[model samples]
Target: MDVDEERQRSLKRSLLCLCAAELVMMVNTTAFNVALPNIAESLGAGMAEQQWIVSSYNLVFAAVVLLAGFMGDRLGHLRTMIAGLGMFVVASAIGLAAGNVPVLLVSRSIMGAGAGVVIPMGQALLGILFRGPALSRAMTAWAIAGTLGVPFGPLVGGALTATLGWRGIFGFDGVVFLAVIAVIRMNVPRTGGSRKSRSLHVPWASVAMMFAGFTLFSAGLVNAQHGVLTAGAWMPMAVGAALITGFVLHDRASRNPLMELGLMRDPSFAACAPALMMLNFSMYGIIFIMPAYLETVLRHGALIGGMLLMPLVVASIAGARMNDRIVSRIGPRGTSLLALGCLAAGMLTIGAAMWWPDGMMRQSTVLVGQLMAGLGLGAGQPAMLTWAMGRVPIGQSGAGSSLLTVFRQFGSIIGVGIFGSIQSGLYTAEFHDLAQSAGLAPQSAGSVTLDFQRAADMTGMTGDLMRQAASRAYESAMTGSFAAAAAVIAATLGVVALISRRTPR
Candidate 1:
């Protein structure tokens, strides 16, 4: 074979290895969701603690991504990725050994940090390896791996948890990491010396401001679900707003800023960022609540719940692959609008399913809605990523991609915390009312409430009273979540429309 042909073959192999590494990272993120109840049961965790298991990982992941992106640029993507894989392997092992909630959470946070490093670096390497149509094809594959991981994680993790137990998921992750390490060592070519080490001087003030702002924004949304009207919630939200404002100003002023403010100013990035966040917010909100609705309200097992939800992931992979062709034909704006419409329609369909009379037919309706919703999400994601990153300078692709991932993570955090709180509050109130109506004694009513709460906590419940109450409450919560998601999608449509109008297509 010719030398150029050999080089091309080598590059393709490296990109595939990078994609494998990224898939491992993505699996770790969602694998824990299906295992949340099992983790809580084994650790004797409360709702707040279990929530932390998910949220803390996202919190650290989102917070460190910008920094990690810069490090990838300065430290050489290959070197940084190897280091990240090492951290991930260690973190997974620690999580496997964790005997308590705090230890598990700490492990998750470390894992998130490792992920934050690995993802952007892998994307950066891909960007460096391919160009033009080749670049697009490489990215299309990358996006598919990512989209597949979210849904596939739970399906596999559910099976693993049932068979080998929750801890086994971590062991699986460890094995995956070891395999990736071997691939990286063998296939990934060394791209010579690192760029001059960028000074490790983080803008402490800006970092503080960003965290405060995100925390406040998340807290406010969380409080809103509980009907809590307090200054504490609103205060942080306001403070967060001010902090973000200051952060932008600081970025503009800094000689070597952590993030490029100019990137945010790009029309494509600005428009696509919010749209991406909304897409994830809606997608995760559905993922978070739907399983509970299926298992507890419909009396399905973990296997069945996972199986019924398969359409979302399956359609997402299809949509992402199709997005490349769709973008070429319709352009980003038109394609995004069409995709968002599909998403809104899917959510509405799910809401309608809830309103339907309970029976096998309602279950079928819900399943159909989930399939449509998955299609919408899958279609939207790749187009959004392409539009956002395509507009940025090639050198800054790592930073831009990291920003997209960070916003998506933040959206997940916001979605789960807000939606979970809403579902919990509504379920608790409805269960209490139903128990009283059933003429149970006060003590019995309390016991019923406790059982309902346990079901919510476990993400499943089945009993005559518990089922009736849980069905009513879960239906209400799911409907509300869908409505909110629809509103967000509508807003995204407006944003993308404005962008299409201003920018020459």
Candidate 2:
């Protein structure tokens, strides 16, 4: 009956709506992984094209999010979010109607732009609504909504693709975002974009430099898998490194930098970026590879592969729900260290499973590893967000949150591009050798190695043998990839240790 209570209730509703909108964005990100095989099949995409399908969105998102964050601060969160959601709807329409690979990629990139704008403002709105304990709880809810999309994304995508078809997937996103726009218009309070002069400092140069740097770097990594020593691989990498250096120098010289480069000077906020990067590197890296492995190498349907990921998804949800409680009890440092340890253990376990000779047992081992990895990331990630954002000035919440997203997306690009390339290369080499040893001609064996369905077409007892050989090769490659990931995770653990020691008890 009181105005204050009524205001509080309305704010909560707005937060819930924003969380829901964010969930839609997160779902669009990973849901497409399950759909990639179907999309590739429909569009006749190759390995590089398939990887690009996933990476293109991430690359654009990472590059542009910082600008969006700054814009949200200057332009007003609600208004910026509406613009982003509108872009999402248009992109979804493009995706729904896309008849070829190039068009689909362009559509995905535009969707990434929308997401880059919307997501940071979602976090900024939470910062606007709550602080301290309430802030902690709000973040957990927001993170859970986003995290839910990760594990369940495949299942939702799989079912949609199987039942309604891949086009329906984009159709669903378009419909939800349209509804979200209506909700925002009706529910969210509006304010002017800027209280100060509207001539805000927008760093167009930084955007160009960062985008070029990440693009070249990722392209180089993808090329490395196929041609490790080629100019195509190393030259781009060198150029990328140079561009990134230029970006840092350029950003530092800017009167109002796109991101607070000074934030890295603070130990806790600094560590969070790398920690977030590795968390995604470990999480999305495996996720990027799994569907293809299950569908192509194991000859399972996309639905089955999606279903198999349920344990990982379930465990992640459980972990994210428990995050606030864990942080409350053990503190952020302890919580982060625990999560990092879980990630390392999980990756190592997956590596072991990949090394296992028995196929059935390997699947079980992978499931267990997924559980550990999911829980680790789900719990630790919120803590990183909490700790990092807690240090940010409230006025710049959008910028801070967007920087965090940039790091995460950057990691995703690295994880998918590099890991996929490595897995593909290793599998190619092993499958080629095995096919020749099976008495097949090198050319025929080479052709089969190039195409997944052809490998499946080998029939009867010989076909079974060939399939088994290919599976072993894939497993070996996957194990190697997991092991490498585990090493990266271990380094992440070291970073957590530094934060843990400095964090107050």
Candidate 3:
């Protein structure tokens, strides 16, 4: 083949492989939500354990990402990605054979480790392979794939779980994981990639500090269920804060910094990073609450919950597709403001649905809220990426981009932890109040509060009463939680509008 044609072919193949692999990884990030109830039932896990099941992967991913990036720089991005894929496959296998919650969590943490290695490495490889227009197009497609996978995860996961049971989801992942590995091997030529070719280095101390800091902070957030101010939550959070403070000092002093801290100086970048984080923050908060709410409070199956979320998935895709056109008319800042507004509005609408009696009107209202929030979140992402990256110093774009990714992950972890804490606390308080009013033992409230499914399964009027109380508690909790999330986004939106300079037509 001619050199030009071969180069084009190679680029196309590499881009295609990267996008598909990334889609699968991103899908797994949220897909496991569909299996939580079933997993809990089968393994006898409680609320805290279930939360960790969803959390462990994200925790591990945020913690280990820099180390993974360093490995990519040393061993070749493609090589690192493949090894990560291997880790993902094995983790899926472990998930399948696991008999207990701890074992399952161990498997998920491994998958998170895989994600850590693969995603950053994939981004690096794309940068290495493409330039200018090709690079831009590759990144857009890459971002879209990631965007679609998150909501799509629940859809695919639900279908798998409903048809094949919870283990089916893991089994399906294993199959797809193998296919991703196969596609990369078959399509990408052997001549591609390098081993230790460049001098991009990350210090081991920085890696350790970052991982520990992120992990501890998230762990503290996990304990926020007890109370954000309580010792269980605050103590760990204080230590984590200290460690993170130490990390900042160390990074500033070190010659080989893990992140491009300088990017924060750009007005657009500073606004863009936090704004994108709120998007994930809102998205993840909704994602975390809905699955448990559907499966536990409403007693719907995973498949039903997944089906209900279609409006969100569809709207997010539509918004992403419509983003460029929206930018052309209103500019990036307006588009971003519009996006956050929709998210805040959509969340409020979802919370409002609980006010209605159980019927079609309630469900339909929920769907509308999903559409609004999904559209806003989806619409803003492409613009955010393009805007932030444009301001990034050319040679340091990789580090800048990685920092943003870490930010997004941090947003996810925090959203889930804080929102989960909010829901749990409110649910328990309402349930306890009701249990006490009925003259039931406080011990009864403990199980009822922690495990909705168990409380729901008890026999007679007592069971029915607690069930009603549980449902009402969930409704009240979601209302408060959703409103809180909206308030945060709205406040952020206002700040961003003030800080970000108007985009030129």
Q: What is the C-alpha RMSD of each candidate to the true structure, in Å?
A: 3.4, 2.2, 2.8
Model 2 lDDT vs. the true structure?
Answer: 0.80
Which ten residues in a row are the worst by lDDT in model 1? 440-449
Tell me which of candidates 1 and 3 scores higher on TM-score.
Answer: 3
Task: Name the Cα RMSD for model 2.
Answer: 2.2
Estimate TM-scores for all models: 0.90, 0.94, 0.91
**Residue-level lDDT tens digits of model 3 in 294-369:** 7666677888887777788789878888877887788777887889899999999998888888668887888899
lDDT of 2 by residue, 307-407 (tens): 88788778878888999889889887778778888888898898789777777898889989999998987898778788888888777777788888888
Give the top-scoring candidate (TM-score). 2
Query: Of the candidates shown, which would achieve the greatest lDDT relative to the real structure?
Result: 2
How would you encode candidate 1's per-residue C-alpha lDDT over 293-391 as one tens digit per residue?
Answer: 654456564556666677778888888778878879988777777888888788877877777775777777777877777777777776777677677
Model 2 per-residue lDDT at 54 = 81
Per-model lDDT: 0.71, 0.80, 0.77
